[model samples]
Target chain A: MHFMTALKAAWRQRDSLLCVGLDPDPAKLPAHLAGQPEAIFEFCREIVDATADLACCFKPQIAYFAAQRAEDQLEALIEHIHRRHPEVPVILDAKRGDIGSTAEQYAIEAFERYGADAITVSPYMGRDSVEPYFAYPDKGVILLCRTSNAGGSDLQFLDVGGPAGQERLFERVARLVAEEWNTGGNCGLVVGATFPDEIARVRQLTGDLPLLVPGIGAQGGDIEATVKAGCSADGSGLMISSSRAILYASRGEDFAEAARRVATATRDAINVHRPT
Target chain B: MHFMTALKAAWRQRDSLLCVGLDPDPAKLPAHLAGQPEAIFEFCREIVDATADLACCFKPQIAYFAAQRAEDQLEALIEHIHRRHPEVPVILDAKRGDIGSTAEQYAIEAFERYGADAITVSPYMGRDSVEPYFAYPDKGVILLCRTSNAGGSDLQFLDVGGPAGQERLFERVARLVAEEWNTGGNCGLVVGATFPDEIARVRQLTGDLPLLVPGIGAQGGDIEATVKAGCSADGSGLMISSSRAILYASRGEDFAEAARRVATATRDAINVHRPT
Candidate 1:
């Protein structure tokens, strides 16, 4: 099935807009898992088991695993998650961007090697850096725009001189990407939940394109405002992601259950604000 | 030693400003080494061996290796180059930009795992993302500004309405980074060779911050103009990089020798335009 269709199906079945961000920071892992690569795998496995029903999707930030040189363990953990719960789509949060040729290799790694239903990309290198990823009909490419950090406004919100006299850089990027780059419906934009006004403006410019709304949890973004700003015309297409708030819900042995409770609260909050 | 001091020492020893970019595309490798990962390692090893004496530094673009899932090979290649030719500096060309916490992990990976003398970073995430890399006093952190690609101007040159009214985004980034982020002179900016006017402007803002200027070869950037635009007041803070134009100089067995000739020519061209 296509990535969009699969995402929609998962959202409907789980009745959740929450995407549990699996950013397994080894330093912050439960004491039982300290210094054990296998423990990392076990921690992820337990989290997935507990919150599989509460999450619409699972986003594994590749950097956490890549940093540890735990490629084999990461692969094992991902395989375990997919094998056991085939219904939940995995969005690999690897903000990779490169030239056309190199981009192809990353596409292969994300889709073929890691089996990610969607991957995040940095748009700094321009459209060619992203076009290669669209060759995969079943994978979605989410471009970074208006990140959830305080410093994001430094460049992203700059008043770039455009035909409209003055416009925010992210608005122009959103327009260009929506009109020019969305040859297929596989394109999405990552608008941080922290900026609801920008998110609303970007949603208007993007039309039907999906929005991956990260920063709902540990980033301290207001959940109600994010849902109102990012929900599509049909009241879908927002993947509200929460990493540390959910993954490190507790540093004790009961971390998995704490994670589930947090995921459940996030899901309930989204449903409360979600359009009927 | 401080990064600037090391850069100056390399420049004095080689009497050259050349920083060879090792971006070996798997598809572009010689026919004999097609479909083999070891070929990339061999190809990079040969280039490093051939040009170690002629060049001051070697910049291996992380994307090229990362696109191939060849990080291990890249680590080994960098270690080999350093072991065999300790005089030359190895700059890892990875434009990594993430949150402060994530950036710490990346710093550890780039400096500790790969042992890079300097690593390139994307300043899009703000000062927090970049400051973590500077925690290591000896390692250099090169920030992206005024990139060489055609679409770079789409955002980098945007009129960001800041305290400096109508300032270009990259110019603002350069000024803020130089003033605030460079506490140890370990900070640098990547001012592309393609834009001489922008380079000269950024050069003034950067003051003594070392600049890694890519787009010299294969990208059609003028060598003399780049040197004139980027040379520091002291004639000691620029590292001009070229990749395919040198490494893929020949497709035959004599490829290494061909690379050497190109490196010599590139080095000579930079020397001719060096600020007296």
Candidate 2:
């Protein structure tokens, strides 16, 4: 199945738009899992088991794994998620960009080596850097549109001249992704949930294309406002991601159950604001 | 020593501005080395040894190594470079960006795990994402500005209002980087050798900051024009990078010798245009 089809199926199956970011920090893992070589993998495995039923997808930030030289563990974790929760999609939050040939190798790393259903990319390098990812029609190429960080405004908000007069860099990116880049129909945007207004603006620009919205929980974005601004007309296209808030809900032995409770509440809260 | 001082010292010692990219593609490796699990390492190791004395630095694009699950080789290559050619810097071509905490992890991956003297980064996510790399005062953090690829024009060329007047996105990036982001003095820019005009513009914006210029050789960049446009007043600030044209100069057993020949020619070509 294509990435969009699989994503929609997962969304329907879980009845949730929550994507738990499995960005494990060794400093924050349960004390028992601390100092263990397999701590990152063990903590992520438990988190997936606890919240897989409540999430539409799981986003494993590659930095956390790569930091500890745990790419082997990352590959294993993705395979485990696929085996355990076949319906849930996995998105690797690795904002990679390079020249054409190098981009192909990166695509292989994200899709072939790790088996991620979706991968994030940066549009700074232009079309050739991103086209390689489109070869996998079944995989999602999520581009950074409007990020949640304060520095995002540094470049993304610049007003550039376009065919339709002046448009912000992020708006231009959303338009280009929707019109020029989504030929395979697997392209999506990473618009931060923290920017509810920009979320609405990106939605207006891209229509019903999937938006992997990050920056919700620990980043202090309002879930109600995010759902109100980011949802498609049919009410089902946004995937609001939360990491630290859910991952480190409690630093104790009950971390898994605590994660479950927070995941469930987040899902329920999003659904309440979601259109009927 | 800081990254700039080391780079200048290496440039002066080598009497060249050439930076050979160690992007090893398995399919393109010598037939004898193919199918060998250590092909990536052997190809890169041979290429480095052959060209080390002729070049100023060695850049290993991480994607090729990661695709073949040869990060161990990547580490080995960096160690080999540091041991064999201590004066020549190794810039890991990883255009990584993320949130703050994750950026720190990426810093660890590039500096700690791979032991690269410098690493490339994407400025898309703003200041925070690029700041972590600056933590290492001795390490170089090269940012992508005007890339050589066609897609680079997609976003990098868009004109936006700046302090003085309308400025292209890449120009704005160059200015911001030179003005604000180089507090640690370990900053550099990746301006494609393909775009000489933009390289000149970036040089004007960032006076003496080192420029890592790719898109030469196999990418069809003009060396004379690149040096004429990108070099500092002293003719030593630009590192002209070429990968395939030098690494795969021959497909047979003489690949190493062929690479050395190409490296010498490229360095001599750049020197002819360098100012005395």
Candidate 3:
């Protein structure tokens, strides 16, 4: 059940590149679900059931659950997803970065306690910080590179000097991730869909590795540009994630059905740009 | 109270710069506490009470609690510290990094949910990612710069391009934190004690802002060099943190008292090298 194997199977069966990001903001929950007991879990479970067949994966942003003091619900949500939709993998979008043993604890939190198939991690602490996550063998580690946010340019665009020549910070990260850090071939890069040019560059550096592109939907990323620039040689290896737009599409009693509609449209739209 | 104000007052009253790192490893608990239900909380609360007067602040690495499904304990532990040792601020060593509303959720998780006075964050995502944390005006944000881990050099030491001149990635982060990013004068930088030279380098860049030094004790960081290089002109702008060598000092029933002895000695050792 290595992440890539599970994800590729999912992408083929569902015919999707969409990763449903489960960022259940308590303040933004639907009128029916808001203020309800276990609201985060209840809302997310409905979304998962509605979109399970359409999505390549589910990404639970841990911060949202933690902020609401509903970590127990996060645990329950992941369990429900696993039991109900064993086809789709879960990537815990924790973005955790620490060294040595601490990293191992986070790995356990994401993969063991939460049962996520993969986890997003910050690479600021470098190799050791990331390697501990690899201990799970099947779990995937997605590193942040060329984020969609404007402030991402503040450092990621900086060109690194050395024998490495003029490779920009993100480019160097891509190269390093593709070569050195991809120890078990379970590594991926998070290249924002908003920056399709950078996404293409990262694709060139990382070869066939999956790129989890987060943007699109509410972030205004062009789906066609993202698909054309990010897809692998086989026209896959991309997870174009959309959160707010899909999650809160209607915010009514039919929210889950509306989410399924949005997820369906998003998947078909991405497939239209997929190379034949 | 603002983080720096509370920290400075603690340092002056306690006469120490030690940030007792509460990384309670469930697997490595003492003989008597190994299988206890609330062992993590009991161990940490005891350690806190023992080292409260001897240390300037307490830093609970969130992963340790999250891995053991003890986040409730982490919340309870922070509440206990706030009530008991109100003088000492708690830093949630999360190394969290995300963007916009997601970042705001993380801030709420740290400042509001866990009631931590400060939280460590990764600056790889740049401004907006770090800015949400600043929304808590009184709280502090410490960015990762020159982390202690060996792999830290993989990207942090690279020379940035463009108008930033030959400044290394960490130096640029330091400059940004000091100049543009410290919107409300409540930002700090994390420079590992393992690299005193980089610490001095970061100290030179960030001015009088606090630098959290986390590689001393078990990590083999030289206390004198760390204190000398990291201290401000006023001799009180650093929190030299140590974890394993202090926490697992004895591993017996008196583990709490042993932690106190190590924290006390480490604090006094740091004072010996202070400029004042």
Candidate 4:
């Protein structure tokens, strides 16, 4: 299935715009699962079971798994999600970019090895670096546009002269990806929810292209403002992701129940402002 | 030891500017090592042993290893290099960038887990994304500037209006890294040898800062022109890397010896235009 089709089906079935980030940091794992060999997988599994129905997608940041040398566990988590909750898409937040052959290798790693439904990619190397990920038409390629970080303005906000006249670097990227690079129709932009005004502007630039808005909840992004600015006319095409906020709602044994509570609240919060 | 110090030491001891890229494709492995679990490591081990004396550094592209789920092998290779060829620094060409916390994980994965002396990073998300890698003052963070691929011009060549008047996007990145971002003196720029003009321009822009020049050999980069345009006045500050040409010089049982021959020729070719 095409990424957009899968995404829409997920959004419809779950009645959600929420994308829960499954970043299982070893230091933050629950006390019970602390010393276990499969801590990462087990933590993610419980979270998936608890919030699978409330989330439109589950984003597993690859860095956390890679840091602990638990890539095998990451693969298992993705497989578990696929087997148990097939409706929810898995976005592997890898943010990887490279030239040609290397980029192809990364695509294989994300799509084939890890079995992620979608993966984030960096666009710093321009089109060729990002094109390889687009080869999987069934998967989504979420390119980093305006990040939520404080230093995001350092290079992203530069005024670059382009075919579309003088626009901020991020705006130019939005225009390019929306106009020229969306040939595959599997492209998406990662515009942080922390910057709602930028999100609105990017929405204007990209039209109907899906936006994966991070920085909500843990990053303190205004949920109503993000939903208002990021949503499409049909009240879809937006993925409001929250990682730390839901994952560690309560570090105790009720972590799964707490995560479900936050996930449901986040999904409802996004829907309240989403266009009807 | 600081990355520059280690790099200079390696350059001096090896008396070469060539950075042999250890990207072992499983399909390309020798017949004897075809189905072996340690094929990737053994292939790289032989290649490293053959070309270690002729090259200044070894850059193992992480994607290739990650594709095969051989990160353990990658770690073993880095350890092997450190044990046997202690002088040659290993630059893990990851091109990784993300938000602060995730970037920290990537930093640990590169510097702590893999023990790479340097790692390549993407500067798309700006300062904070690349800052984590800089925390290790001893390791190097080589940022992508002008890439070698065909679509490199897509966004990188945009005419961005910056503090220094109207400069291309890559130039702005060059200026940013050279002028303000290199406070730790552990930063380098990746300027592809395919674009000698950009290399020269970047050389002029970033004085004294080292350049990691790829696109040599199989990428059809002119070695002499690259050396002439990329090298600093004292003829150092440049790491000319070639991967495919050296690794696949001969696919037969003499692959190791063929690799060494090509590596030596590449080093010699790079030295012809070096400032004496």
> Which model is ahead, 1 or 4, in terms of TM-score?
4
The single-chain TM-score for chain B of candidate 3 is 0.98
Distance from true location, Cα of A10 in model 2, Å? 1.5
**Model 3, which residues run further than 4 Å from truth?**
A162-164, B162-164
lDDT of each: 0.84, 0.92, 0.91, 0.90
Q: How good is the docking of model 1, by CAPRI class?
A: acceptable
For residues B1-276, write the lDDT of model 4, one tens digit per residue: 787998998778777889999899887887888899998999999999999998889999999999999999999999999999998999999999999999999999999999999999988999888988888989999999999877888889988776657799899899999999999999999999999999999999999889999998777889888998988987888999999999988888899999999998889988888999
- Interface RMSD to the true structure, each candidate: 2.1, 0.7, 0.8, 0.9
Tens-place lDDT digits, model 1, residues A1-276: 688888899888888889888888888999988987487788899999999998878898877877787666667777887899888888888777655655787787788777888898877667777888999988888888888888877678778878878888888788878988888888888899999999999999988788888888778899999999888877877999999998898999999999989989889999899899
Compute the DockQ of candidate 2: 0.90
Model 4, which residues run further than 4 Å from truth?
Answer: none
Model 2, B41-117: lDDT tens digits are 88999999999888888899999998989999999889988888888889999999887888999999999998888
* Per-candidate total of colliding backbone pairs: 0, 2, 0, 0
The fnat of each candidate, in order, is 0.32, 0.90, 0.89, 0.85
Report per-candidate DockQ.
0.47, 0.90, 0.88, 0.85
Tens-place lDDT digits, model 1, residues B1-276: 565677778888888889999988877777777776588898899989999888878999876776677888898999997799877888888778877777787887888888898888887767777888888899889988878877677668777777866798889889988988887778888887889999999989877678888888888899999988888887767889989899889888888999999999999999888888
In TM-score terms, candidate 4 sits at: 0.99
lDDT of 2 by residue, A1-276 (tens): 577888899788889999999999888899988999889999999999999999999999999999899999999999999999988989999999999899999999999999999999999999899999998989999999999888899999999978888899999999999999999999999999889999999999998999999998878889999999999998899989998999999989999999999999999999999999
